[model samples]
Target: HSPYFNGANKSTEVDYVQVYKDVADLLEDNDYDDGSYGPVLVRLAWHASGTYDVDTKTGGSNSASMRFEPEALHGANNGLKVARDLLEPIKAKHPNISYGDLWTLAGVAAIQELGGPTIPWRPGRTDGTSAESCTPDGRLPDATKKQDHIRNIFYRMGFNDQEIVALTGAHALGRCHPDRSGFEGPWSEQPTLFSNEYFKVISEREWIKKELKNGGWQWVDKNNTDVMMLPAEISMFNDKEFRKYFELYAKDQDQFFKDFTNAFAKLTELGVPFKGDEKVYKFETLPVVVT
Candidate 1:
């Protein structure tokens, strides 16, 4: 009885961890944003998994439905084509892996490669074969909104205040592009790596309302306007409950890693229907390890 059975004869053993890692090996590009595909890979993984609806077990990473129209064209998913394209070659080589598994796994690999916690991921999300499986837009958080909007968005997805704070730590990894999200700048000094810096900066940085060249408002670090925080990010400080958890992460990186791993593990698996008992593997970090 071999594990990782993909319903293919149930006999041969495949090292999906290595397959995922090999795929992650190709995530670097000198010409792209952040000098690596890590940021967009994180975005791709996020947009894919962020669509889960708790009330109705649908719209998660299970099907990779974002490949289809409408969902791919969703205003929120703007500029993700690069991430998808980066993963395509790997998909071509590993014909057995589903788009859902490849996408979510790539996210895990990206986070690990970027100095994040080791995420426990399972590979049972089969490819979403039909366009009907696409989730509607608006499932993800809106950067322009405040606490109520932020809570409404995440709460609908079954996340509480503490988990929401932990998940926002991912902002530590990527910057806002005016072309994509109509917002600009990195949340941390080192935008490509994962750390509790987002929380730390959110708490300590002297911020002020600044309009980007694109004409959108965001809180920018007074020291360097090139660094910014979205309204949603600022909401953590404005709201008391959120601030408590935010302060904790800012002071303690280790605890943040553990909470983020737990919250993100739950997030990536939203709406995914695994067998009663399935093994979750913690993928090894890619050697291209950044700060």
Candidate 2:
């Protein structure tokens, strides 16, 4: 019963439920952004897996390749070291668990702890050895690009239009740091609590394009100017295909939660090799906060 070679090449046993708890416990920090590391942890998991190339079958979360300098130093990955560093202690405590598993699971923990849906997840990713495993640059979507560019990026990762829109709804959490992404502000007023606010923002708010002091520009709310949306996010509204789903999500929080969770679960699991019979773990979330 111990070996249970779920998907890893070697025999290993991991108590993923305990790992989930540990990651969840670490989500809150009064010193970090939004007093929670949830958003960046989600970003870390996303960047790690978003590199997948469906045609070539290369890249993805399979190897936890971001541990190598080449991938970590990639422009799209800027500032993710903070997420990795936070999870380092968790990794150190559980040496048998691969970085691929830890990073993805941490993302799930972040979402659930932040009042999002429970993500279906399993383990079986192993770390790669060298920088050679790093995916090429430009694989991740550019925040400055528009609809065509957004489609090109996500399409390569095998996401269709609906999934594409559901995935981008993740922007609801965490603000963009000007120092990191050369953009600033949260897409939603409640940046820490995950909800359909991002969809609502895209559909309802009138955004004004603001030129940042850093020489880059993003759309800020016409009224507030504090919250913002990337050019790529705006594309969701302009494109007829992408517009359909975000419009639906903005109106239906339950449907948004369902689709977003499914899309995100798929995102984290991209290219991860797991045995067909591997247990799908739906880790329990913290009790709902009564505010």
Candidate 3:
């Protein structure tokens, strides 16, 4: 009658706090990540949940449909399998947790691991059937598009201009893969840590475009640096409205964290129906103990 086995018997009724603790512990134990798995986990959670369209109420985090063939084969979903596989061990340990909750919790784990803000999370999502999952292609933002294109894509997902800018703040975590997004380099040198560096570099640096080593419409920094920005992200600087929020986020880390956490939480719950309190829970931050 092990607690772990007993816990599986009542999987649907497991406490959110215990689930959070388990995932957080797992993240702490794994040190194989490049910078931090935090950002990539954030990206994974975002990609998993961001597909929902309220109009159709079709796709969302509930199904973990990324496991299914149709969703996995999507163009925007490329490279996400790595993120999914990374969580398999955690899933094995806690068989009671739904993929939807597991994916989103991984995000909370990553953020907390990287010294970012605590993203208040709750769990009531059940495993949805494959028939319940289906978001059209192009729902996710295209890296190569312009500001208007970014607006069109995100807006369709029911995000406003402010939320759109806040959501892109996730670029602070992961980079554009030449093989995946057809874009190259990390958004910042420290892609694993959570910071406003993405906005800082985009606003302060002078970017020169170079031919991509892997081909396609990719561009590298003229300074021969490792950082890269997609056509869509650069449009934030080029467009007045987008730049306004970017500047605000750059100048104030607290403001960016507040907005980003709210937007990301909203993004995760896009298509779900929850009648309980929507209060956000800020988790206790992990301390840095240097040897």
Candidate 4:
């Protein structure tokens, strides 16, 4: 009887377009970092899904396991509680929606609202009831590590070189917080606006390795000194294969959008068991207001 329901599978019947709008409306706040929760929301979806291991198929956003202990306290997921807590009211509003679907959809909303690509999304993921479904520590990429480590982590999730490069372009959005990641600063000058800037910075800037007061290492742009890159990102420049893709993305924003949409959609869907008939929804982006 309700327009939001087909009365068949309840998960598929919930109006996800409204959910997207709800999440979009909460992305900005003056007190928050760079004035938006968009970046961290993207990270929430990424860490939730990036844990998938192709061999065992044990991890992914399907469980929304990060809400539990161990995974919530994971070092890689540090500071993500802000993103989760921000979405809590939405979860309360849409009681029937799965945490997995809500988080991943929030990610799609963040990207689109921040001027990135439209991510194809759907619902059907069910929440894991307890901490037993949590992924082990170290499933995420370590910023201190090199290209080899990046490959090992992503390869386990079934992404190849190009997809890996496309996914890393997400560094374009958020900054590393000193208290959270033990690193500081953003990869792009405009950290809140999504673009090809992450790759462009890598290609254009001369990065000088700097040791933080926290005893961590990151590369600062030799000229600007404010923007930074983690060692894992610098590895993209050093590795021949990785370099090829980032370089291309630096020159072409359209290509970057296309590849990133595909790779990120794949990342979020990992381990999700969607009934074949569930419709894929592409929510409309909010209109820009010109000054």
Candidate 5:
């Protein structure tokens, strides 16, 4: 049952799973900046889902209103419109799909496109009204904090320690831009592919304190001249408890993928409830073709 080949336009006949595959194809076709689109796609999904607050019910992925003024203007949301704009053509092709669903689907697309595990996604999320716009600026995690801070921010969004570690595994896919997060360089050289390289680097490399030219905390890898890490990311190494899971993930990529997929699935569904049994979709993996 090909998506473009059969029943392409029937609204009721639209398979959400096919939409996921279509977005995956698009991501593979347009991987830029780091040889892959994985990182930005992960960040796009995070920014979209991070807006949810369990207590207030004020923000969540349901709205897709980040297209509006105040939410788009958020300092934490900087560099994200690049991702949203990249998806505009896809949205244009499939007007019936909500932006909420599209953004999350893009994340799944990026992951599978870059050789990650299957992410189970569903389609009950609908676009919200313009009135339902604007989340506070600091809803996202600060890259300068420690374990306690990570716990506070993520816990506020209903994530546990395991989920936090799993979600942070996304660091393996994208680098911190000095312009965006004020952190420079990538966690792994292959920042586009999904893997447990972040943990491997932390466990295997020797880190030296980076010179502070502009009063920011950064680190240099003892083994490599170019790789770096943020204070927040390094804390995963400094803390005893966090390091345990990090080491486990570092040793096994498959375990990391499994844990990450489960955690990401939970992360995207922060405040939504399923009316029936939950369904998980496994996407096909693309061949590794070097260009």
Candidate 6:
């Protein structure tokens, strides 16, 4: 299927599984934060899909609408341009794949390669041409807010408490950059690798609030200054509604991985209506020491 439809039958097929492997290779960067592009790739995949609105059913990864002006310029999308720019070369190599699929696939690759769960994917999303195709701001979760805010946002995407907890488990793999999200530090010690470490750390560690030079408050590990958690992360464990699954995932990592796979698969498919045949791949990450 053509990623972009332009009034002509321009559909072409590219071996996207190979493309997924290529994406996995690109994610390893020794100089970048935690020696991997995993975190940012996760963010890229997330922002690309998180725009779903149950009421209007307008946003999602279907159009890759973030490529347009106002969508790219939204405050919530601050610093995502880097993720888009990093993916440019892959897009150049395979022009037939739409940005929607490319971005979403990149995320799936990051998760599998960085030590997370399998994500089922299908292609059929067409690219949108203008800023009007972009969604309004405020669809993503704000790390500074509490449970209610997290619920309002994810609930719009049709996630329940358990699904929300499972999705938040992704915080296991990424960190917050002071420049990007106006916050700092990784949620888990091994920030590059994906694991249930996020749930473990949030549930087991003691975090103390510390103010940055800019006056923003973030929770730091009492044992490690390099580790951190956001208000949103803390709320999951503290709030009764989310804690059941939150604690469940923390105690049982295998369960977390399974739940995350299902939740993430659904998250990416929010507005995508696929043709009957779609592919599901459980990508195997190359061992850290690849000869």
- lDDT score of model 4? 0.93
Residue 86 displacement (Å), model 1: 0.6
Give per-model CA RMSD: 3.2, 3.2, 3.4, 2.3, 3.9, 3.7
- Please provide the root mean square deviation of candidate 5 (C-alpha atoms, Å): 3.9
Writing each residue's lDDT as its tens digit, candidate 1 over 1-291 gives 555455556433346877767766776677777777787888888889889888987788999999999899998999999789878888777777788888888888888888899999987887778789998889998888898888888888899999999998998988888888999888988988899999888899899999667667899999988889998778767899999999999999999999999998888888887985766797777554457
Off by over 4 Å in 3: 1-11, 26-33, 277-281, 287-289
RMSD of 1: 3.2
- How would the candidate models be sorted by lDDT, starting from the highest? 4, 2, 6, 1, 5, 3
RMSD of 3: 3.4
Model 2 pairs whose backbones collide: none
CA lDDT, candidate 6, residue 279: 67
Error of 3 at 279 (Å): 8.5
lDDT of 4 by residue, 188-253 (tens): 889999999999999999989998998778999999998998988888689999999988999999
Q: Between prediction 3 and prediction 6, which has the larger TM-score?
A: 6
In candidate 6, what are the lDDT values of residues 1-291, reduced to their tens digit?
564564355447766887787898798778888888878888888898999988899899999999998889887788888889999999988899989989988999999987777777777778988887889888999989999999999999998989999998898887888887888988988888888988889888888998987788899999997899887778767999898887898899999998999989888878986886766655666667747
What is the lDDT of every predicted structure here? 0.85, 0.90, 0.76, 0.93, 0.77, 0.85
Point out where model 5 deviates above 4 Å. 1-9, 28-31, 212-214, 277-280, 287-291
Report the CA-based lDDT of candidate 3 relative to the real structure: 0.76
What count of clashes does model 6 give? Answer: 0
Best by lDDT: 4
Tell me the tens digit of each residue's lDDT in model 2 across 99-155. 999999999999988888999998888789899889998999998988899899999
* lDDT at residue 228 of model 4 (Cα atoms): 94
Give the distance in Å from residue 276's predicted Cα in candidate 1 to where it truly belongs.
3.2
Per-residue lDDT for 1-291 in model 5, tens only?
A: 788655655764446666766666666434466665557877888888887787887666777768888888877788888789878887777778788878887888787777678888876567777855667777888877777888788888888777788788888887777667677788877777788888888778888888655578787798785788878778867788778888889888888999999888877776555566645656666656688
- The predicted structure with the larger TM-score, 3 or 4, is 4
What is residue 17's positional error in candidate 3, in angstroms? 3.2
